[model samples]
Target: MTNDPLKAAWQTANIPAHDDLQAVVRARGGHPVMSRIRRQLLLEGGCYILFLLVYYDFFDGHRRPLYLNIILVLSVACMLMQHLNGYLLASSALKGPDIFRSLQQKVLQLKQYAWLSVGSRVLGWCGIMVFFCTGITWTNAKYGLLAGAIIIMGVQMAMLWQLWQRRINRIKNTLAELNG
Candidate 1:
């Protein structure tokens, strides 16, 4: 009854450690999608932090409206939270036991993460929009920045949706196989 795709893939690849299944589990956690997510979190989180530091002047004075300041900061905070959740999920997946129950738990965590990611992206973008709308008097640059942000966020949302679908379906199928 050894119909496990991971096992089959390892055998087909001549990985030579079929008895040490935990190594295979560890290797699976290093999948490209997880790597991409980690890199994205690091890159975006770093850039956002840098942007805040560099633009602290714009946010600090008595000139800025409270709501605008709050919205702008909230947008960055939403992004940070989302990235942190993703990091935690990826780390947990790696630590999970090499068993069907662990796989099931990972699938559930992934489903939760997919929803959280979508919701956070929406909230973050909405905050950005509100910030731009409220701070129109602060700078004409708001319009250009909003437009660019929309395009970037749109592309990112699409990528995230695709990744979510691919990973979720893969895990669901694996779970189904284990259950069936």
Candidate 2:
């Protein structure tokens, strides 16, 4: 009688499906971090758009050479696109047909995004510097200011790259665990 009741209880227990488990595992891909990053990207993208709207008047884009204006616009647009890409990437929920395959796909996507992020940062930095320094007659103080700005930009780039690498490494470690 005791064995019969215990078997009945065990048989009646609900178990989640494999697909449900896969969905849950994929959902664990940095929900909070993705949300926060997406929000930030939205805010920054908006600001960049607004800057583009007003730059001609406020920043004398009209006075700058055609090439300089083009460079600034292209750089800002590239950065904006990268920001949008980041937001979309974060929202991606599909892992793949299988967990390992999905993770491999994710790693590939992240590597591409990392390159885009760094490349856009460098391009935008260069574009802004060229646009702003175009008409300036080089002086000692101006040279000093430019040096300082370059140093600051370099540090910022290093920090951002480090952050990207850390996120990538975390995913790689997870993949390693699965593989091992």
Candidate 3:
């Protein structure tokens, strides 16, 4: 049978369907896994720009204070670790079931993503606090925080939107098959 256009689109985008995803997990050959890993790494690498912005806004003005320097270093490290963990999780094959086998894994992944989002926000807040405390006098702190929150929210929303679209398309396809 010819594939559904929506399924084709999803496959082209490398987002696997429920059954196809199981095959993808079992299949042991090809660049698809590596490509996914690379994509995630690229996404994670985006935090560097934020780091630079924080550095320029707070550190470049005057001699860096000890506390600010330490916090900056810790923030960068935490961001890196958070992204790396997410990359690993997303790249790995879903063992056993396509979805979580137990409530634990589901809760764990949710908590992991939540922590990453919260950690990012905390890092941004730290940058804002440092800027204020160091007498940098910047107006962008509130806007920056809002933008960061929006980004995190967007990630979750986009994932859910894709899933919802996929389900609707799948149901339409099944109906068409039954009618035809």
lDDT of 1: 0.78
Candidate 3, residues 60-135, lDDT tens digits: the string is 6347666676665666666666667766765555454433243335445555565564556466456645544664
Model 1, 1-180: lDDT tens digits are: 367999878777855564467577566876577688889989999988886676557644246687777777888788789989988888663335667878877878888899899889888888867765653565568668878878988888889888998999998888889888
Q: Per-residue alpha-carbon lDDT of model 2 for 43-108, expressed as tens digits?
A: 998999999999999999988889999999998998898888888887877578888888889888
CA lDDT, every prediction? 0.78, 0.88, 0.60
Error of 1 at 116 (Å): 0.8
Candidate 2 displacement at residue 25 in angstroms? 14
Per-candidate TM equals 0.65, 0.81, 0.45
TM-score of model 2 (CA atoms): 0.81
Count of residue pairs whose backbone atoms collide, per candidate: 0, 0, 0
Two-way TM-score contest, 1 vs 2, winner: 2
How many angstroms is residue 119 displaced in model 3 relative to the true structure, after the best TM-score fit? Answer: 3.2
Q: TM-score of predicted model 3?
A: 0.45
Lowest lDDT block of 10, candidate 2: 25-34
